[model samples]
Target: MRNINEGENESKRSPQSIVREVIQGGQSVMSADARADARFVESESVIAENILSILCVPLIIKERIAGAIYVDHRQARHLFSQKDLNFLEAFADQAAIAIENARLYEELEEARTRLSLENESLRREVLVEKHLDSVVGQSEAVAKIQFSIRKAASGNSTVLLRGESGSGKGLVARIIHNVSPRRNGPFIKFNCAALPETLAESELFGHEKGAFTGADRRKLGRFELANNGTIFLDEIGKVTLAIQAKLLRVVEDKEFERVGGTQTIKTDVKIIAATNLDIERAIDQGTFREDLYYRLNIIPLVMPPLRDRKDDIPLLAEHFIRKICRDLGIETKHLEPGVLDLFVRYNWPGNIRELEATLHRAIVMSNGDTITRNDFYGLFGDIVPASPDAGPVPMPGSLLNPVIGKMDITSDIYDEVMSSVDRQLIERALESSGGRIREAARRLGLAR
Candidate 1:
């Protein structure tokens, strides 16, 4: 400690400085040396020097020796001892490791700070775009469909969507179109089942002047108007065999002759046809042509029914509820504690459409803000079992009862029948409450 200031100012920073300092100071008690005597070394080293009867040691960091330390006396036959070298080597090894560890720790902290900043930037980007918000649900089926949609949309291909009624095949078609290069073009839709046979041909192909009895002038059909765009042929399986042949020619050759016209009209359109019916079944039944089916099914996309994706039920239900509320100008509604549990438990035959209708009915009938169990089941009439000991039930008299009530009202008794509705409602409300004053008070919003 006494020579530390002068030793730091030394010109040569080699091991000689350490040797000189140790020889001058009595504190240089080196260890780990096997030598019998000590000698003078360089004076510029920041290391311990040999002392007579002391140990010589090696300085190390992380188990790797960087340099050696010497301690004790010099210039004589066996003047210093060997024990000092051993002590110096042990102390140098520990100090070297400590220094290396501290440097590493600082580096690690810097890396962690940089990683945190990168993660924060990624989170902000996701939120700003609202990307994840639009793609909800984690079902493998949904994820697979998303992957396919992205992979198939890179090229311009004719896509066919097939599924059951109420399934979102049309929606899938729109997603494909929106992700494709033709996204900017108009999307046109037509239902083959909605048009009669006589009008279906005229609907798909434009009509010439005086084409039929109702043809007052030339009118463009769906195909002509959908030029340079995408045309969605919904319910494709239902198109007549005659119309199917016509469609095949149009789809294959990109040209069709209008009804009652000789001129061949060419069209530039991307076709995306959708069908709820099974094309194979229609072909087997001789209702649909095989050649037309193959043309429309080039890039087939099948959408599974909603019941198959039970995991997405809650998300889909909530989405429909919000949509219904928005369209109806009604307040937003929430599910009760067990409402979702019970809803998912039931077999949804009508799929998302059924669940959406249920939620709509519940919301419209709900009196209070929160939707409750009673409000959900209020749409249906519940039948109760009679007591075993009770006699056969008898119908009660009521003026408003459709069958027993008087339908013939003259000018004098007209007012009497109209007032019966008010009295019956109050009596029914009291009966449903089991005659409890406080319960009935709450049901009718009467202050207790």
Candidate 2:
């Protein structure tokens, strides 16, 4: 509230003086005649403004003085009595309550909004972890990959995924993005090898309308769409040198301009690039940028090929079986005893993708609830050895005759012969031990 007249005496005559006194003293201040009172006789404002009566009280709430309230009348002396002071004090108490309630309400609203955002972030994180569980492996190599993924997801560094083509680099990239701090943001993927050189720049950096021939409208690029999120660049080694230069700028500066636009647009995105190419070889050949390679190699994660982690074959096969069955709307199928052994023996050149495809094919061709080695007859070719004859050999030396006769002298001849011998020995032990694996292993002098 402003004073009615502006003057040197205005500050002193204003009710603020009384309010301050009341608040500081934590009590009411009532002056029936302020100008005549000893407290104001020496005050220039009290006399010049003809301040006559005043009533002020502290606004206390919850044992704390929130503020003060004051009322005054200039034309009347002895106008404010103890009764009037009591009335103003009561009103002040009610005002303090209203202020505290409003404050509490605002605080509650703020807490609600904060919790809502936190809950949403947690929800996205949960979804991301669930998606990452699909990595599906229990081998040491797989465990290392998973650990690297967790470590990589905790930061904003650029990641370079090195692996064979079908070794699940793309899946690992998605898992990294999903579990990272930027999980809630968009996850945009671009296959660097999918586009031609002429369109690679426009696809990554966008272009304004009429920037080039056949340009009918403005289009946002992968980087722009991936702002404040993650952008996955698959087959990163396939992009041309010219496009690599643009990618380097965005990695180093976090800024870029559309193909035809002069305005520099900023973006906050986490980049994850995957490739099967030997990056060091490419760099040496001048096919890839060295600086960009260093920038992207901040967090390098190598995906293990399926053959290297053959122990996980059974798990992966079962996982894929259940998935394929569900997708095909059929009953889940189980593998025959020898099928797993066959899978372990063959070298899956196409890695996990090939394994999945092989399983899908086998499942589709299967006529019963179980998939046998015959189901994959032509798939593995000569790798699938023929079952031994039903009759027992007259002597142990006779077993070597058939095995030695069928074997070819090659670099892997030792492993091939041992694998066949091991299979035959285990089969004979199991048959003698009533199909008990532990008894069979014990009879074969092998530890369980």
Candidate 3:
């Protein structure tokens, strides 16, 4: 570098010719003058120059040249010394390691992000497969339900599934029918809620020609169509008292006479009834018969509510959001941690159905490419508000009461009483046990 600078500064040859000579060497070091003409751009070590006495060295580790260092000397009558060249080489070595370290750190960060995204995608795919195949969650309560479904599927037991709406009884019934020996046979579904009371009997049992004003020709009922298969009775609780007795006769003897026809038809179809209503209450109120309840409740499966399986909500939410986005013809968006927070805290009165609907609405309503808290604002207000039965609910009132109604602060109430009891019990327990939380927990029957 010193010899090159000495020749160039004296104009022994043009600066352009010196720059070309430097580029001819497949090395890392170069020097240039103040003319700003091309000095170097590394060959095996490409670099730039025009500031003479500028030392450029390649920072290489293994086979990678991480970076280069360019040191400029602007002083007059200055020329590079052998000692300065040696020092510059050492600086280049140190610079190479530092550059390598920084590059390694960036690569590690990029790898971490890539792994996280891959893992998230794999998790999402598993969830979608489960939801699409209808393989539901594995809560202990669900095991009991499955056991009942097995019994109902194997024999001629008429099942009555009791749970809140959206508890997946319909899905459970379908699973039972699909897994049973009758899967190859026809399986039909009927929603009693969507069926009118006057036409429910006709819907259940086909009417003959001219049986009624609309019966212009013969028609097959759900039972006939689903012959030798399974008949899924959804929302069976909505059936009237008359329909209940008729259903009981079919369950007991498998005999039914079509409307305005004397001939009796026998059906080999299995009956799997589902209801979100309390059949016991319906029976007591004369809307359902006790004998029919006994027959159907023989293979009873009681599905648990959403609050009981809180852990499953996060997985289910993501699964449902993906499915909804696909159905809506939109790109899938992930839920931020805040969205999970909102979902976990809000009580799901409508259960899985409610969560699905909320996510579908949010995906459509979101403005940005990513979903955030702003996307869900005001949407969850209904689920998070104070319960109405929590005394009047403080609504905008008429002449009788004001908008901000006074709260009853009675100590006997649930919130205050529980809080007071909790504090006093904790204090007494802690004192007796000398602040040993484990011992205190033992005394109070609490799990540590």
Q: Which candidate is the best by lDDT?
A: 2
Task: Give Cα distance to truth, residue 66, candidate 1, Å.
Answer: 99
Instruction: Give TM-scores for every candidate, taking all chains together and pairing residue i with residue i.
Output: 0.54, 0.59, 0.55
Instruction: Give the per-residue lDDT digits (tens) of candidate 3, residues 1-448.
Output: 2234544544432234333443444255544443342534332222233344555555556556544444555443235556666787788777777767866775675455435543543453442331213645566665666676667778767777888988777677777776788876666777887977768888788777789898765656777667788888888888888888878888888888877778889989889989998778987888878888888777788878877877778777777777887777788888754567667778788887777778777788886555666677676666653465677435343632342145465656667656776888787777556456798899889997
> In model 2, what are the clashing residue pairs, if there are any?
32-78
* Model 2 TM-score, all chains together: 0.59
- Top TM-score model: 2
Q: What tens digits encode model 1's per-residue C-alpha lDDT throughout 361-390?
A: 888888755666677774323323336467
Give me the overall lDDT of model 2. Answer: 0.81
Which residue window of length 10 is worst by lDDT in model 1? 124-133
Off by over 4 Å in 3: 1-135, 382-448
Report the error of model 1 at residue 233, Å.
0.7
lDDT of each prediction vs. the true structure? 0.65, 0.81, 0.68
**How far is each candidate from the true structure, as Cα RMSD in Å?**
28.5, 15.4, 32.3
